[model samples]
Target: MNNRAARVALALICGAVFGFGLSLSGMMNPIRVRGFLDIFGAWDPSLAFVMAGAVGVATVGVRIMRHLSRPVLDTEFHLPAARRIDGRLIGGTALFGIGWGMAGFCPGPALASLPLGLPAVAAFVVTMALGMTVHDRLVVRSK
Candidate 1:
């Protein structure tokens, strides 16, 4: 009914839809993601389509949102305009890639796979959460 409630409802619906889409598309399966990433092995390129679709949707969404005078429930759209190349950004990206390559699971897929009750997925999620907390407290604070 209120602005906060509307935002929370929208977030929940969006998250549910995203989780459903990930599960339906087989993106939540570590084996499938590993197969896609293994270029020299039995590489499956289907994940490329998934990523392309996401990018396409995001592109359109950003374009439409940019043209709006203001956000529906806010004064303006708070968009990031940072274009600075920094060590923190590069290091974080490399770490993320290395972790994803090793575990065959990104944050989204790791969380989505929780319903399957896989031990490795659970471990990954736990470690990811701990890492996030440490980063926020230590690395982010030092910056």
Candidate 2:
């Protein structure tokens, strides 16, 4: 297949796998996620294990990939180049944390939960897209 087709196929496969993993780990459930975040209340520790497993897999994967001269499907791994944390980064992170704590749905789990056909999740996704568009136009383009 062509390069574009290969990239699209890889993205789809990766998304499917990620969604399935989130569902299987109960991360798609807002209640479960909120419970995990509620340390002062009836907190759940199950998500901690899930996060640990994900981190472990990622650590190993990154280490293995580091030995390779280049990615199999790409010329190079497009890792983040930014090292300095600026005000924009801090503000964005705070906004994300506030949204996640309030709605109990980060972008990944929110998108994964979209398959359930819930109005709230749909609204969240729409708002997320709008936020991204605004940020892209105002912040990203300005920079």
Model 2 alpha-carbon drift over 4 Å, by segment: none
Model 2 residue 23 lDDT score: 96
Q: Which whole-number lDDT from 0 to 100 does residue 62 have in model 1?
A: 91
Clash counts for the predictions, in order: 0, 0
Candidate 2 lDDT, 1-143, residue by residue in tens: 99889989999999999999999999988899899999999999999999999999999999999999998788988899999999978998999988988888999999999989999999999999999999899988987
lDDT of candidates 1 onward, in order: 0.91, 0.93
Clashing pairs in 1: none
Q: After superposition, how far is residue 86 of candidate 1 from its true place, in Å?
A: 2.3
- By lDDT, who's the top model here? 2
Query: For model 2, which pairs clash?
Result: none
The digit string of per-residue lDDT tens for model 1 on 28-127 reads: 8878888888999999999999999999999999999988999887888897798887997899899998888889899998998898898999999999
